[model samples]
Target: MKNSREIIVDILLKVEKEGTYLQLLLKKELDGFESLDKSFITEVATGAMKRQITIDYIINEVSTIKINKMKPFIRNLLRMSVYQLKYLDKIPAHAVIDEAVKLTKKKGYATLTKFVNAVLRNVDRQDIILPDDDLSVKYSIAPWIIDSWSVTYGPVIAEKIANELSANRAKVSARINTLKTTKTDLINFLVNESVIPLPGNIYPDEYLYLNGVNDIASMKSFAEGLFTIQDESAGIVSHVVNPLAGEYILDLCSAPGGKSTHLAQLSQNQANIISTDIFEHKIDLVKKNASRLGAGSICAELYDEKDIDKFVGRFDKVLIDVPCSGLGLLKRKPDINFNRNEYHIAQINATQKSIAKTAASFLKPGGSLVYSTCTLNKTENELMVDYISALGLVPDCTLIDYVPDMFKEFVSGGHVTIFPFVANTDGFFIAKFKK
Candidate 1:
């Protein structure tokens, strides 16, 4: 049987080699492990992936062979080992090196065991220096990402963004389904399950920040759909939409239906909600989440956002939580740190503009539309808001009322970019407009 370290290395290898999402693979690979082992595996695997750039820098500083020249297995193994050595101070360096050697041999790299041992030993003894001038290397973020943030948000905010993303705080936000359970009741359930529930800054009455929730799937309340996992920032978008009872709401590019289902709940299940996504499988996820949450008013459908002629001007409210570069979710989804780049941002921007345009067309002349994204990228957030407003939709400054007083300052001209540090939630953007 593979030990926890081996499992972690396997998980990291797949993430680096195959672009597997670290979170999804962890769920599949961690089954049957003890809680402690599971935690270790998750931390090391995720940390290695998050700090890949920094880890590679450390490796190259100590080793004659650069990380890129090494085999994928060796590259990831060294990265994981370096992460433990540098960040996980609790683990002894000798033990880490010994395990790396053993794992190298086990993986049919017996000839390279001595090389691995020597390189790791050098890393342990070397007083490695990070390039202070290169924020990308210091933060393990790509250069393009660092440059974009620095230019858009300025150096201080950009560095804070990097720091927040690297912190990787473990907190899960759960939104209570008021139609089924009250906040007190859900807190009681979470307490019964040994999960600590803390008050959420945004929508505290309907939201809780959970800790020690190892397996949400095992929680009876979760299976029962008493609440759903959603970032308080995401929950804010639903409120910004402010769906009303008996109104028609169109949620374009909606899948897994977080906002759409929340809209149904906010409307007390009385609104007619059409939630759509291009992929049939993603649409199925919307249907499942809506059904599980008992948001019966949500109608999940497979439809492309680019083609909205059939439903133009037919809805009282329209929500376009368009796909973004996901830079804001770095703390939650660290894989995005390495996977996304400048080209991806440009491609997504066009799609976002198209979706925003189509979403405006979907709204009636007097209807309200909320455009949102879980990203800190200005091109995707502020610039997209500009593009939408240019299409003649008037910015609705009243959106400031829907958010908490603390976030009100971020609101300017009906749009706000919620920094992760400011909100203690995902860095999100919200813009409300009237067609």
Candidate 2:
């Protein structure tokens, strides 16, 4: 069996070669590991992934062979090792070097052990000097991302966003399934199960900030439809919709059904909701989540855009959590930093416009529609808001009145962009309109 460090190297290499998501890969690699080992693996792998560019910059400063020229195995092995030497203050330097050397020998690169050892030692001894002009190298974000954010938001705020996203160990937040259990009852149940539950910064009554629960899906409470994992910022979107009992709602592009399930609970499981996704597998995910959360009122369906005429003018509220560049999710999904680019953003922006046009068409006259994305880009956010407004739907400024007081400062003109640094949540944008 492979040890933790070997698993870390494998996770990093797969991310680079296969373009897989870091979190998903890490989860798959973590089964059967002890709790402490799982924690260590999670920390080092995610830390290394988040700081890839920075780690590479430091490696190139010390090694004769730049990171790009090294074999994939050697490059990733050095990357994870260097991450420990530079970032993890608790680990002894000798231990990190010893493990790297042993892994090189075990992986059949015995000849390169000395090379790995010398580079890691040099990395430890070298003075870390980051570029003053390039925030991307320092913050470990893609250059275009940093530059675009700097132009959209000021350089200072953009730097702040980069620094915050680069930071490790994002908190996990979950909402109680009201249909299955009350908040008080769920808290008692979680306490007995050895999971620590704290009040959330926003919606403290409904959401709990969870800790010490490594594998939430394996818990009996989760299987019993007691709660669903969601970020606090994502939970806020359902509040913006403010669905009431007996209202008809359409959640276009709902998958794994976070907001759709929340809307069902918000409306006392009385609102008629149709959760639709383009893929059959994703629709199955929505169905599974809805069933698990006791949100049986939610109807999951395969969405065919060509058959749009049936959904037109049929709902009281429409939610299009449109697919985005996922720039806002850097802290949780570090692979996004490596995978996304400007050209991809432009392509997704057109898809966002198309989805919004369809979502607007779903609402009845005077019905409300909420357009949201977990990305921070203007082209996918503010510009898309304008495009929807041009469709003759007026911006519903009253959405601000429902926003929690903690997030009120971020709201302007009834639209809010929750920056990770400022709002302490995923970087998200939301705007509401009436058809």
Best by TM-score: 2
- For model 1, residues 1-435, the per-residue Cα lDDT tens digits are 899888988988887778888889999999889989998998899888888888888899989898899988888889889999999999999999999999999999999999999999999999999999988889888888888889988999899888778765746899999878999999998899999999987778988999887888888999999999999888889888898888999898798888988999999999999999989999999999998899999888889645667898899999889999888888878899767887899999999998888778888889998999989888898887788889999999989889777788778898988888875788899999998
Clashing residue pairs for model 1: none
Residues 187-291, candidate 2: write the lDDT tens digits: 999999999999877778888988998888789999998999998889889999999988999999899899999999999899999999999999999999998
* Local distance difference test, each candidate: 0.88, 0.90
Alpha-carbon RMSD, each predicted model: 2.0, 1.6
TM-score of each: 0.94, 0.96
Give the lowest summed-lDDT range of ten residues in model 2: 163-172
| Candidate that would win on lDDT | 2
